[model samples]
Target: MTKMIVGLGNPGDRYDGTKHNMGFMALDLLAKEYQTDFKMEKTFIAEVAQTFVNGEKVFLVKPQTFMNESGRAVKPLLTYFNIDPEDLSVVFDDMDSPVGRVRLRQKGSSGGHNGIKSILTHVGTEHFNHVKIGIGRPKNGMKVVNHVLTKFDSEDNSEAQDGIFKAVDAIKYYIENNDFTKAMNKFN
Candidate 1:
């Protein structure tokens, strides 16, 4: 069975380095490690990359439909690939977790995240896996929208980068072992 790993983020260079783009950033790290690259798949409205982990086929995806509308791309990709929701793992930012932290959940609600909400709506379930990287909540009365759209400050940048690396490692561990529980135990 092919495992589908998805990272949710807005498309374009304008969104690069923002807190919300952590998902995309994590997949980029994995791509570099695997010596693979994403090619835009217009039909799916996503950037797709194929690779192998312990000889298991894996599809790395970055939805290009923007954040709130992620389902627009994800639903089609999963349908076309014929991958079950159970075989899907989504990585995205979580404002509730502190910087430098990553959390893995086998199933859960969106926690008020629009991207996850979209996925849940289109995918029709929350039974899939989640890999959430902490972006922390807005600081000093900063608005939530601005907090997610902006790049981290110098101090936060390093911590955020660390979280991204950990996320990538966790995903790789899951793909190789084919066990979500073990990956969570080892990396969460």
Candidate 2:
């Protein structure tokens, strides 16, 4: 099966440096590693790049539908490509983990992330792989929405980059081994 990676984030320049857009940035890193670029696909309502990893074809995607409605981009692409969810992987930011940390999971609930919730609903299953980069939750008196949408600090920005590199390595491991568990064990 062709491997599919869906990186969740809002579209446009306003969201450029926010932690919420970590997924897109991570995929951007992957694209750079493969020396490829994304082209906006009207059919999928997303920016997509195609490249090979360990001789396996991989599709890197960034939904143009924005963060809360990412499923709109993901579902159609999966259908159009006739790709199975088992061969799919999602990369996104997670507030539950601390900065500089990431966790890989084979399956899980959305953990209240609207983008992930949308994906779960559209995909009709929770069995795909998740590569979550830590963005950290809001401190006392801060709102969740504001925290995610805001740009990261110097410390968090540097740490998030570390997490992105780790996520990229984890992705290569997953692609090479065809095993989510192995990626988790090594990178999480």
TM-scores vs. true structure, each candidate: 0.98, 0.97
Q: What is the C-alpha lDDT profile of model 2 across 82-147, one tens digit per residue?
A: 889888899999999997598999999999999999999999999889999999989777899999
* TM value for model 1: 0.98
Provide the overall lDDT of each model, using Cα atoms, as 2-decimal numbers: 0.94, 0.90
Candidate 2 residue spans exceeding 4 A from truth? none
Candidate 1 backbone collisions, by pair: none
C-alpha lDDT of candidate 2 relative to the true structure: 0.90
Per-residue C-alpha lDDT of model 1 across residues 1-188, encoded as one tens digit per residue: 88999998888889999999999999999889888999999988899999987878899999999999998898888899899999999999999999869999999999999999999999999999999999999999999999999999998999999999999999989998999999999987
Q: Tell me the spans in candidate 1 whose CA falls farther than 4 Å from its real position.
A: none
RMSD to native, candidate 2: 1.0
